[model samples]
Target chain A: MKLYLGVAKDIVVKRTIDRRDQKRVLGNLYDYDVVIKYEIENFKDQPVILDLAESMRALRSEIGVNNQRDVEWELVADSTLTDKLDEKKSTADQAVFHVSLPLRGKDDKAVKQTHTIHLRIKNEW
Target chain B: MKLNGILTLTLALLATMPTAAKNVDLSTIPPRDTVQLTIYNSEDLTLVRETRTVTFKKGVNPLQFSWANTLIDPSSVDLRFKTHAGELELLDTTFPHDKPQMLYWAVRSEMDGDAELEVTYFTSGISWSADYVCISDPAEELMSFDGFVRITNNSGEDYADAQVRMVVGTINLVEKVRELAQRGLVSRDEAKDYERSRRKAGAFKADAKNELLSKLRADFAMAENAARQPKKIVKEGLSEYFIFSVEGTETMKNGWSKRMRLFQGHNVPFRIQYRYRPQEYGEQLVRMFLLRNDTVSRLGSTPLPDGVVRLYRDNGRDGLSFSIEQQIKYVPIGQEIELNLGRDPEVIHEWVSIRSWRNAFWFRRHGASVYYAPGKGHRIKINDAVVGWDEHQAWVERIRNYRDKPIDLQIRRSFDGHVVFRSNLEPSLNDYRSPQLTAQVEAGEKKELRYELVFHQGHNQKQTNVTLESVN
Candidate 1:
């Protein structure tokens, strides 16, 4: 499996100095549109539905995603024509992740960040 | 019958007597044909030249000029004819022994027609100065500079539709022109000589004619430059002076001032410099904008007159700072113009005297003791005393850049005495004329520089020898 972290660069947007008023402001701070994806190859069996949920839960915790509405996960399209996966099936051949994270400081003010995401994959039997 | 004949004879004699001719009133002077006001920046001195056509009766006409309630220097007043130089002759100028603030010009005109006469005089309470406003971009590499000229007139005389010229240079005057105007007095000896000359020749021609002739020549030389341009200041260099003539004629009433825009520069390149000097500014770094006044820097067409500069930052918005009043410095063409814009919170400066010690000693002399002698009334014996000590002091200067971006901060140290020993940071500039030391500090960095100095006491030695012997 290969990990692809996309759009992790810093983005700056305008920030007001005073919280009550929007007229007075300083320089701008950028925003980040983060996209995290995992590419898996040569999988003989479908992954358990609980494994997919557990992996996402651990990934969210590792990345320290600020908002819950920012993360989006979906199954990769079924490329093999041998077996047709059910529409309601929870198992997926591959996984794709998308996130919209705002690097912010106190009072939800946009700020510059040098954050790093640490992901560890472990198999315990 | 005899009494009636005598009354008739008296009545006939009264009727035959001619009427006495009335003296000309000086108040009904004609309007000015052409007027030029040359204002000086260094002093409240303005030279006025006004030409008017006056009808003179061929004989000696005592033309009176009064400047009551005006700041006109009577001694500096001059009058001459622009046309009919040979036909019209000025005999002399005299002030009435009783009438104050009035002058009489005895002119002998060979022709009876009108002649264009020019009157030149120096007056007080008229001055002009230059000022500017500068706006800079975020990076501080580009700016817009606008220049203006402020003219103030309080000469007690209204100048209507007068051409104005601002002169930038020092004029050597034997007496303060303003004081002379206020005194309203002239040397009686000179007036006596003028009165005597009037009886002999048409006018006493001395300083008045020389001054008028020189001014006329200068005016003719500037006319070529002024005629080419209309509604704009014609700038030209005259020997060691610079003259700026305003484009259109403006009315200058007494106690009134007018501000006229001179020039403007857009997108002119500039540099932001941070300066620190402990003696000049205590523990603070001043921000200054440096720009070159040249064609390469988008300025350099003419020398910039000294003026006040108001700085602003255009960060897609407007921010106004206090205006900086600069001295009357002539920014020559292709020279750098530096405007200090107050202090900057981004750069911090710290200074301290780290260490000091005393090391040298010397001797001193005292008063003499007096004693009675056989021959002489008193004999004096000289006495001498000696004291020794050396004073030494060391200083450390540290400057830190708090801003995230890199900056080359300039630090100037003006030592009260010469530096005996120095360390840290090679001196970028050492000007002994001003006795200033200059260095630059890097951005987001703190630079520490130390210097040791020594002082000698109770010594008859040369001052420069102290720095040589104490090589810390």
Candidate 2:
């Protein structure tokens, strides 16, 4: 484990669940049994920012992933109210701050990593 | 050297691997100006479409300004579509939020003059969603539970849409408090117990005041929001009205709307109108309480209890008597609670007659007039309000004190608290033993003032309600 501070690469998914609405309660709450889906990168060492809640897909098992070049993701948002997030793109508007995998002693230090952050608010009207 | 070569070869293979493809179809779908579609389970899959043109009544005429309630730009659809016998118009899914894709054509038949409108585009996932939110009974007066639904359209895919799901709730401000409470950050000793209990683990404070404060914060947060905005139940089928059936758990958010979160708070029932936004167009709620047992009291005195928002009033023996005659309950949830607007039967109010002589004089001086002096430099106050004004007349002979002085005053009062006095002059007697005149007021809350004036002429007296109500 090394204190590698490139972007401190973070993704904040802010979500606000307003239960005060009748339509929201019946349509959105009734479905999914209220279990929010999250992929979390659950790396035990990695944390995901809560921004685009719709992107989180709970892990059924584990998918084959390339260690060197892959996107790191997380679902970090409180379940009920709106989740606040630090601005994602530090470099630009689409700037998503994220840490890269092979985050360790990969001899391929010259290899660059690319990641995309999506924002989605799937709520009742 | 061989190991390095192997690593390079592996990297090249991974980069060249094929990616999954998303299908797109746009037949029989809603006409929309711009469409944005994204699925959580699968990615690299997105659809954006917009309406381009609309045909008119006849003559192959085309109309502009066509938009869809849900359809996105079709010409820009990314997924490929195959009709029963043919492929659809190829769409480039590039623009994310803008760009028109397809056109809605309303064409009249050249052979029969009949008309047909057609929308051509491509979209995947033959499914869409409809959401419903509900509230059973607000009149019942319980913190309500709202419900929501997510309708998944299976235009013709497979696998039951993996059990379509939708979550409903709000963001609450309780997070900070909760976090602080959990961290044992509350300063007050009482806050400790509350903090401890709320947390699953015991590393919290075990105090009541702190707990009460925390509870108050959560409760008030809910109430303030409830009062300002309608509780929103966001999901499918939100625009139209429907009977929302509560099929699962209920929750709420007590944080800043943008920061609200959900937690199990109340249970929901099926069939209620989900309020997406609270109604903000109403006056401050006025609650009324009536005095049931205590029927009549003094005249023009404390007739009803405090906060008794009376829409109507009737003349009583002493003054005015108000009561709830209609079905208007401010808070009607549990048991039948009764409150009276009339004076409490046990509350005693007393008023003295400064000049109403015993039999003969009292009868004769009825409605008699008084002349207050201008030298008084005072204004008569009824409920602390200045109503009438006069600069000259002092006394109507020994019977009345004329409107003379203008009293400049400021008053602060509560709803149940009222001060009714003549706005002009109070009869000033040089005699030291003037039989100290006074009136007693009791029992009534809520949060206000009344104005009146009195004229005394030895044993013949008359009182006129003057103005000038002031509040501070």
Candidate 1, TM-score of its B chain: 0.75
* Model 1 chain B worst lDDT window (10 residues): B4-13
Candidate 1, TM-score vs. the true structure?
0.61
Badly placed stretches (over 4 Å) of model 1 are A1-125, B1-22, B25-28, B185-228, B279-283, B318-328, B353-395, B414-419, B428-443, B450-472
lDDT of every model, 2 decimals:
0.57, 0.23
lDDT of 2 by residue, B1-472 (tens): 1111110100011111121111112222222322222211121111211222221122222122222322222222122221211212321112112212112221221232222222222223322222112112322222222112233322121221121112111122222222331232223322222223234333332243234334433433333322222344212221111111122222111110111121112322211110101122122111222222111211111111112222222232343333333322322122222322222222222221211101111111123343222235433222121112211111111111111321111121111111123333332222221211122122232111222322232323333322223333
Best by lDDT: 1
The candidate maximizing TM-score is 1
Q: Can you write out model 1's per-residue Cα lDDT over B1-472, one digit (the tens) per residue?
A: 1111111100011211121212333333556777778887676778788878777666666666667767776666777788888987777666665545666677776777778877887777888878888877776789898889999887777887888888877765545567766765544443443445333432333354346447645764566457346698778877667788888788887788999988879899987777776566565778877899998888876788877777777666566544456553779888899887668777777665544444332323344332222123332222323243344556666677777766666666554333344444445434531223355666678777666555444342234421222233
Candidate 2 lDDT score at position B423: 31
